[model samples]
Target: MKRIARVILLLLLVAGLWLALKPTLGNRRLTFLPQHWSEYLDYMDFWLNLGAFAILGLTVWFALGALEKVLQRLCLMIGSITLMNLFLEAMQSSIPGRAMDRADIWAGLLGCILGIATGLAFQLFAVRKKSRTTSPQVLFLDQTGRLGGAELMLLDIAAARAADSEVALFQDGEFRTALENAHVKTHVFKLGEEASAVDKQAGVASALASIPAILDLVLQIARAARAFDVVYANTAKSLIIGGPAARLAGRRLIFHLHDIIADGHFSSLNQKALIFCANYCARKVIANSEATKAAFIASGGRADLCVVVPNGFQIPEERTSTAKTSALRSSLGIQPAAWTVLMAGRLSHWKGQHVLLEALKSVPTAHAILLGDALFTDEDRLYAQRLHTQAEEPELKGRIHFAGFQSDTMPYFDMADAVVHASVFPEPFGRVIVEGMLAGKPVIASRAGGAAEIIQHEQTGLLVDPGNADELAAALLRLQTDTAFSSTLARQARQAAQDTYALDAVQEKIESVIRHIAGSNKSQLLSPAIPLPKPPPCAA
Candidate 1:
């Protein structure tokens, strides 16, 4: 109901903004006179307008108990007004017979500023006049210092300042800067300057090394847990370490799963370890996608504890430049005649870069640009070296190029006619495929994981059988040869991407889940662990 109200309010705001600014927009630029401003101002109008919204906003705020919950109350107020202003900006774009004016946008900005100021003014006045308390906060954990997907989501959460949220990460990673930029308080776990002796050890040695430090870290986190309403574990290591501590502290723990384990990308032991940790420690598990949630349940996880939350994205401006694409191709040493097939991700076997190579052998692409660098485990570094060697093999030489890791893959995506995600194993979520779609490029992905759920073969994008070189090759060939069919697919893919992965839609779903959990009294809301119903042993 609250979510619906919020959406309705935003829609009204958009409508109001459209009404107010309709006189200001067109293909032609125009200026307005400020001298007549006083003529338009009426004393009664000021009182009536301010009073109307103030009353409405306060009613909502008070009903939502914002008076008692400081941060959340502030979030509600800010989010409401921010959406209002954003809608107003959007309204500045002409709507048929509607009038559009830049002045109205300026007015909307003024209104937002006044609203926020009014809110702060009221808060300050109330505090000065009386005493008030704030609710406990939720600590959002992100151990990965880099501003990757986990960090990006954490940044958005921080920006929302939703439900007394705060962020914590490793001391050295780039996430601290991102959090700081978002005006989110940053707390470092400070697990020393480097991974402890135990963290550096692999297999048994590494497991032993991580145990004590992790346990100690858990205790420390448990102590700090007093300040938070809940401790959210955003990374695998944190889930393993922080879950027990949160439980010990009698606090709720949320373990967010961003990756799928049984995807054979991780070693057998690594997969088992992740499941074991999740099963034993997490009070609740938040899977980034329904596919991940299903995978977890299949591996003896508690279904009741699992919550499906798909990934979100902010659509980037479409960049068009034939010259830029040509430049990118030139820099990569590709001939204009060669068709450049692209695959992007952190270079890893689990990511299925090798699958792309195996498929490449069956296809007749002019060249392929493999983008990304070794990340997380070094298990795939040697595999990458071997892939390079394979690329140099008699038939494949000069046909495959290692482009290394690129922060901005837009140029690469633009250079390629189609983007491929040939993951032999299921991906927890295939962000690249969506990104490719958003870039208005057709995609071919493995029929597993999130890709299976998002792509409709021949409609939005192509899906090939996982680990099947022949199918992937055929899909690639069809895309390369059939421009009309490919364009249709790209168009549909873009629409689907916009509809499903757009920031606002994705954020709405995420916020709804967070609001639901925050409203609950239990620190941990475990999903029921139900056994998977058997399918009659494959009818053998």
Candidate 2:
């Protein structure tokens, strides 16, 4: 038809102009072809280039249509063109007989920029055409009546504080109070009476009895997800409760994995449940370490679906406690002359406080202070009771002091000679070791899990075999008796902590990962969302 012929004619004319102008538009050899022809063509080239871009502009405008969502498209186009310019410049510098043409590069960049601006303008116009919509929301969920590691993480995150974070606790108790104190938005669900509760309301018994309460919690998550673009679950119980709700609300689900497993923390039955839900129910699992990521894969969870983002810290400008040094020492009833050894964590068996007590039998001149106690789930209260009994032993009596639980540990950290983490099990990420190092204190941690990853042997701090009393005693004696060696370790420890675990460096890595994920998401949206092709199977 006539329309087809006219389209062909337009295409031919455009091709002719490009072919005629190619040599002049490229390289610094502007006059190589023919002087007169070059002058004439160069002038024409400017307008032709403009026209080409105008056509490109029009094509982009048409492609976006009435939707008018232009910035993303503009960013895509401009970013692609900029990368190409870099490549061309590198080629010109490397290739023989080809000099870098600054003007041509600028022209190309200008054309790309103008094209992108025009696309954005069209998109802005489209936005004017669309109706108003609400901003997206975020939902956070945690189980247990106590505020411990996960609760502290959420509180610190909120206090920083990010926008659009809402926290809900599975059972209400002390954690609710702490959440309130932090000025964080929180909801507490009463699973049962105090007596029948798990750790007074933290258990499967309470969770099962509160079927109606669970349904309500599900409804809240569903509502929140509908309002938000994504629903992020901060606990395993939340994934059990919030994952289905998010799916029902047509929202994405993200799981934050704080716990690391090797073979036997959870029963096989529970592990199977975690693996199934992590693989099929959630869009992504954010693990705190590479070890955690590998564990997920080994446990039959999707390897590709896991992301590793280390937990970040905000180094306080000042230590948490302001009491005079003498007062802090006096509060623990320590004589001015005693060498104080401080341990700051819940006084539980797994924390290896009992082992520390036994280790103290060998390091006589040192007075040890156990700072934290009976925090988190009361499920460990019996273990704490045993620790209390061990501490009260006639011979061990006056040497050790149990300072129940203090919100601020910095004052104690300031007063102590050294900080120690003697965990029997591998911690996913031990903040205490990092915290101690940041305080410029010499640290001794068990050689286990993320602790091993963070501390360099004989450099940052000393690492002893976990649950070994004699090894811990030896490390204690070395720091206590050898002042120069302790000073050397302390100096190196602070430097490493600042260099590696400093807030900004960790944040930069997190930002890089997030930007990469965001870019990947955009790419997926641009391409047809055909199911990702199955990867080839490994040979037996």
Winning model by lDDT? 1
Q: What is the lDDT of candidate 1?
A: 0.68
TM-scores, one per candidate:
0.67, 0.67
Local error of candidate 1 at residue 5 (angstroms): 43
> All candidates: CA RMSD in angstroms?
21.6, 16.7
Summarize candidate 2's per-residue lDDT along 60-135 as a digit string, tens digits.
4444322212345556766665565556655666554455656555665677677656655655444334312322
lDDT of 1 by residue, 16-79 (tens): 5444464532322222435344335422334434544554454344334322335555566656
Candidate 1 lowest-lDDT run of ten = 531-540
lDDT of 2: 0.67
Candidate 1: deviation at residue 492, Å? 0.6
**Can you give the lDDT of residue 494 in candidate 2?**
81
| lDDT (0 to 1) per candidate | 0.68, 0.67
